[model samples]
Target: MDWGSIFSNAMASALGPDAIVYALAAIGLNVHFGYTGLLNFGQAGFMAVAAYGLAASVATWGLPFWVGIAIGFGAALLLALLLGVPTLRLRADYLAIATIASAEILRLVFGSVTLSDWFGGSNGRQQFANTFYDMNPYSSRLDFGLFSFSANDAWVFTVGWFLVALSCLAVWSLMRSPWGRVLKSIREDEDAVRSLGKNVFSYKMQALILGGMFGALAGFMLAIKQQSVIPTDYATDITFFAYTALLLGGAGRVLGPVIGAIIFWFLMTFLGGFFSSAASIDLIPDVVMSDIQASLVRFILVGAGLMALMIFRPQGIFGDRREIAIDGR
Candidate 1:
């Protein structure tokens, strides 16, 4: 029951590469649901396609890593268009249904035996990340007193955080521009924006593309960090978690996702460690809860916290309540 180890693990997760990845994903969702009032439940689909695009291009087609990156982003752009073209003009819920269903379809397709040759079924692909690692400058691991990371992890962290920063800056800048104003206006009332002679449909499409591209970048981070890509990694739950992080940090605010990701992972790992350590000390009877059950109980607690947040503080930690008052109509 070493509390130090547990605390270190939790702290690492708070600022780790995984948190950066989720932050990036939530940033994309912020653009859709936060700023533009788009209900894109298939963000995981965008991530999955981008990851597979990169893996298949480099591993199967023998393309360069950079080219694979381009292909992956291209796939994400295509997906956004395909999804938005048919559904954006309809009610918001239609887009939600379409996105969620499309994401599930993609997960199944990638894991299906019929496409095992290209996607490798459920095992996914590796060996494509050598090019990324070959460029790493650090020769040894980074030893920070509380936590340490391999050279590879250090390099990924550098790139991942840089991307997160760049994305946030972009969102901030965009939201201040005329285009950003139109997006916000649409979120509040599409009819009003249309009455002003603005192209609501086109604006929605653009938001979808921009947000999906961000999600695609997140896909790259997740894939490059682990040096592998799996279908299960892009499940529907990932999107839900991103939404949670978005809500936690304060949606419609540029930096909400970043803060939310840190807090969410911190709480998750922190509670996990405390529960596991308590179990080891035999403080609780087995009849109360076993070690395995402790692992899941943390999520239950976090879920309850989220419910409380929704009930008492729906605007989140940094979000202004009015910012989220956009009319879905």
Candidate 2:
């Protein structure tokens, strides 16, 4: 097995665009599920709206890049409002069902034949990110012996990390304020917060909007990194993956999602590389596992690993046990 190549691939994936995208998405999930105790299972919906918002505005309507950015953010905000107003007052499970359903609905709508002209349907949209790439300063690939990134990827890497840093700072600062304390209180017990004459519904809505905005940022990064937007990209698994990252890192803490994202992708890529290499070298019998099966072994191992983590440390690496306790009332 090529251990050197395995390590290199792991390192690259740990710091790659995929990690950045999930980190941002997990951060947004932290705001909703961590700080505010929201059961938003449709985070991918928010991402989709923003991604297609940018893709349609630029690739279809011939708008400037900045306008697309505004539209994406606006769409996220609107989604938050639409989802929150109808479900926040209900039980937490209702919100979860609504969110997950809404996301799937949006995905299907975007991929529908009727909307192909505007959204490009299942084929998706491209040619919308030229303006974004035009500002790249890296001019050449950044090869650091073990791993490398193309000039365009290098640009996204820089901006993505910056956004991660900025998001963490904002979460840290907000969680220290009185408002942030209220959110924690709500997470612990909404009835107690309501007894204090605080408007619980309003706070929930604000958190939803804030978290949705973060999801939108992740969408923008994902869209610009690929310079395309496809409806299938915002599938239900995206939200689950973000949740997994959030849980692994320790939710309710400011930097938990960021660290979790790094570790999650690192382990996933490392295991995949190891299995692929082993299979290629005939270390395992073909009767036991094929090259195709080797690729999927990572998911099984990771799932089992996550199960172990939940059984042993449900709060995650950096999360407090009390933090995961949500107030269903």
At residue 169, give the lDDT of candidate 1. Answer: 99
Off by over 4 Å in 1: 322-329
lDDT of 1 by residue, 1-329 (tens): 78898989998888888898899999999999999999999989999999899998998789999999999999999999999999999999999999999999999999999998998899988778789999999889977899988899989888888999999999999999999999999988999999999999999999999999999988998888998988999999999999999999999999999999999999989999888778767876678889788777889999999999998888999987664464322
Model 1: lDDT equals 0.92
Please report, in order, the local distance difference test score of every candidate based on alpha carbons.
0.92, 0.93
Which ten contiguous residues of candidate 1 have the minimum total lDDT?
320-329
Best by lDDT: 2
The whole-model C-alpha lDDT of candidate 2 against the native structure comes to 0.93
Window of ten residues with lowest summed lDDT in model 2: 320-329
What TM-score number comes out for model 1?
Answer: 0.97
